[model samples]
Target: MTNTALTGVIPPVCTPLTPSYEVDTGSLTRLVDHLVAGGVDALFLLGSTSEVAFLPDRHRKVVLDTVVGHVAGQVPVLAGVIDMTTPRVLDHVDTAVAAGVDAIVATAPFYARTHPAEIRAHFRAIAARAGRPLYAYDLPVSVHTKLGTDLVLDLAAEGVLAGVKDSSGDDGGLRAVILGRRERADIADFSVLTGSELTVDSALWMGASGVVPGLGNVDPHGYVRLVRAARAGDWAAARAEQERLFHLFELVTVGGTRMGGSSSALGAFKAALHLRGVIDHPTTAPPQIPLDEDETARVGKYLAAGGLI
Candidate 1:
């Protein structure tokens, strides 16, 4: 049950990991506190930014338990129930609901060809059994299925989706959902959030309910400030904050040429967190390379430039 309407800057909280790739509970709790202190409206755990796709079942449970326990009820916690299909995702949803997350986020089935009708059915099935508010995670890049704008609106109208986290990077589709919510009285309460850190200001201007910025993990204060600026109709301040965040976002590319996007981007975040003393180690899960010393130094430079260090 979503007790509060999801809004503002809800950082996809990073999962702090030990050198052995275990969940670092102390660091995770501290990171949660950091986000709360930075004034985030809510917390999103086990999302892509949290390395949810790479986490084992045990690790995912530990992460959920740790964040939900630490946060108590300070903010709504959204847990990502990412998997290949309905049955797999249902298992995750059951676990997340048992772990006490306020909501569950699920993407379209991947690793298997699926029709648009199938995708719609997938969400409806999951929503019926999730036992909590379900947010559609529209990430075509990973899921290989672009959720059509009309489809999203229809689902919103049907109440199968409480909200949508638009990470598809399709501005037109995002705007359609945002405007559709306003024009359609039936979907007025449906939340439309964007996970695109690059276009947060524009997304808000387009009537997006909030942001799910991955960069917010390293600097929650920056995202909080940006959201407040946008909400207050201070475009100048909002643009300035967004630009500063854009500059800081360059750190994601510091691990250039040697790593995949996930490794580079997530590594940069962990590196920044370590540089900022938010975590003990900057290591990521296995098979994902850790940023070298120079790459880590570059992360520090970005943090310094952003006044975070």
Candidate 2:
């Protein structure tokens, strides 16, 4: 990894929107302030948690510029240049680089069924011109393609990738990437961050560089504390905190049969933020059902138990 490699609790920030579906600049700024005050090491914008797939290009630009300018070098900002293919992703890459982000994150090609070599070519094309550190976002659930460890290691060895955020839900795969990075002295600084919030204690114990939990948007301080405890080798404390967060994560299921998993999870997050006074409203982008009063109350129950209230 380069000197600019991001580490620690870098939360994938939620995009707070107005009821009319425009970017709520004030609420968005307040959300940035909330994360910074929560002791987050950095911020990740336009990721899955930010409703990146649902947002229009203009809205995406607004979010990238707003958060980056508001942060003003307080913490390293990572922009997710996610799209269907390399060309579209490069467009976002150009925009993000112009906006002055610290890093760029992209995933393997999707929607058109790309081969492994094509995925390699996709990342190589981005790295060659990104003008910033590049991290692979291994999220098989959304993109339908899993970036193999060999592919990642090959790219890292060639300096095309600085780090990887392992959200593949494959613990063995995550370990292999971390171990692969450690095995090579030349790439010893390569970072291996995990997006699995519920198993962060174990991921940290296995030597993950940091975490990028979506739940961090709701309770960033708790994740910071968990990381500190793990760093101090307080495994017991880390486990306790992880379990507490696991309980809080239950709020994601509050939407029940009424909505999809994305709606449930994102809705609960925004709802908790709203109940905590971080944003003006719990509104998601669109089509993702917004949680009603009863569902939001269920989210509050988890927040209260997690002591985030």
Candidate 3:
């Protein structure tokens, strides 16, 4: 939408750190190089998977700089705009642009729950001021705010909204945005990216340009296979692979997790990456309880059993 350019398997990279919780810049560079060479279409740094909310501003800048420096135009880099306040978000845009990021991915402010009118105004203000296109990140499970179709359509109509990464986990919600484009030609260029690995094939079948799957962080090659199969309309093969992927999501999202009410999908994912030597340590931010020795062993066993590690 709005003449924006974004598509394909853009993984929200995890912020790898050392055992002492220090940001591992070396490992980060290596990870970026690894993904880029592995055939990923784009890279998203400081996103939720990257734990940007808990990461300090200095570390955030360092991570962004590391990615931009390593990518060197090999592929487009999307800097995560995690700031909750409008002014702060705009400031992030300026900073990311300075760091050489091609675009930005942002969501509604957490705790504010801004309405459709307010949401439209918020994005419009940012898009007007931002130098690059904004990917409207709709992740209600994390921020508790959903970007409604009306608001998305309105922003596209105003030429301020870019494409949307609908991680709302609702097919109807994602379809609403696609169908809305049918009634309004202004949003005809609006791209819809399904955020789930289970629906990657179906989403593409329905007209999504690409996906931003979390599992891609652990198994980029596997997701690539699914994308190829889906794009080729090989339902028989895609469905079989999707079933295995569904198991992986369930295991990480629901099994072997605790700390709070939520499951430890992030930690589990990080652990898998570490096992693969993609990251140095699976150090999650504070207040996010890491898997203890027993829990870590359990998670490792589960991953090995699933062939994800």
Candidate 4:
């Protein structure tokens, strides 16, 4: 079990894939090295940015093994066990533990309508079975169920959750969790991390323990500087850094006219990585369109504007 709270910039890393959609172990290792060298606090694999829902079982395992082996315990590796049900998620948890992950992140059951009680039960079941720490992933956009503040607090109070990753973009709800933990003496060390890359500075100002910015995969150094500034109470510096990142985030909308948010954002990240020579290819998983030449050029422009190119 992890004794330390997960605090600081932990990017939901994008999985590098070959032309045949195989996990490119060499490129993935280089990506990990880039983030570690950028001074990120941890690495989150197989999360939304990783195309977890689209990756096959074999591909997921390969990614886990490759990243775990490459990282070599230099920083905490949090793996996402994303599945539609408990048994399936447990299977992933088993595989991730076997691959030497420090913790597991799971979302509310998707593709099936589930009640709040069921959501609570789902987390409890995982916590009871998982050998490592489990963090609740509140991604209503994908799971179709928002993890309520009360439910999260209840789980924390009962020791069923080690932390929460709030991607709901609900600052009110995020603040509730942060204040809830602070007011409760029963819940000790419950980490509250935000996945809103655009509002990282505000989230940190609201007392979030950390952030899981997908944009960090493209510019890890910027996020690191933002986190350091926030922690040191340099709000002006943090705001400046975050504003720069927000401008860089415009790359996600470069191809929005022809693709969904995931495709555009993930594609932009991979493209930026490829342009930087951190990865071999900018290919994303299937069913998601890759950025065209014009779109990729837009990404390059944004990188140059951010001084990342």
lDDT of 1 by residue, 92-200 (tens): 9888989999988899999999998999999999889876788999999998999888888898888888899999989999988888888888775788999999889
lDDT of 3 by residue, 1-309 (tens): 133356667888878888777789988887777677667888888877788888887888898888888888888888888777687888887778789888778887766767677777778777776766777899998888878888888887776766788889989888888788667866656767788877887887777778887777877776777778877779878787777777766546433435652327777777777777788887887878776666666666766766865
- Scored by lDDT, model 3 comes in at 0.77
TM-score of each: 0.98, 0.98, 0.92, 0.98
* Per-residue lDDT of 213 in model 4: 95
Candidate 3 Cα misplacement greater than 4 A, ranges:
1-5, 253-257, 261-263, 305-309
CA lDDT, candidate 4, residue 220: 94
Q: What do the candidate models score in CA lDDT, each in turn?
A: 0.90, 0.92, 0.77, 0.92
Across residues 145-248, which tens digit of lDDT does each residue of candidate 2 receive?
A: 99999999999888899899999999999999988888877675688999999999999999998999999999999999999999999999999999999989
Question: Across residues 91-173, which tens digit of lDDT does each residue of candidate 4 receive?
Answer: 99899989999998999998989998999999998888777788999999998999999999999899899999999988999
Candidate 2: which stretches are off by over 4 Å? 1-5
Sorted by lDDT (best first), the order is 4, 2, 1, 3
Better of 1 and 2 by lDDT: 2
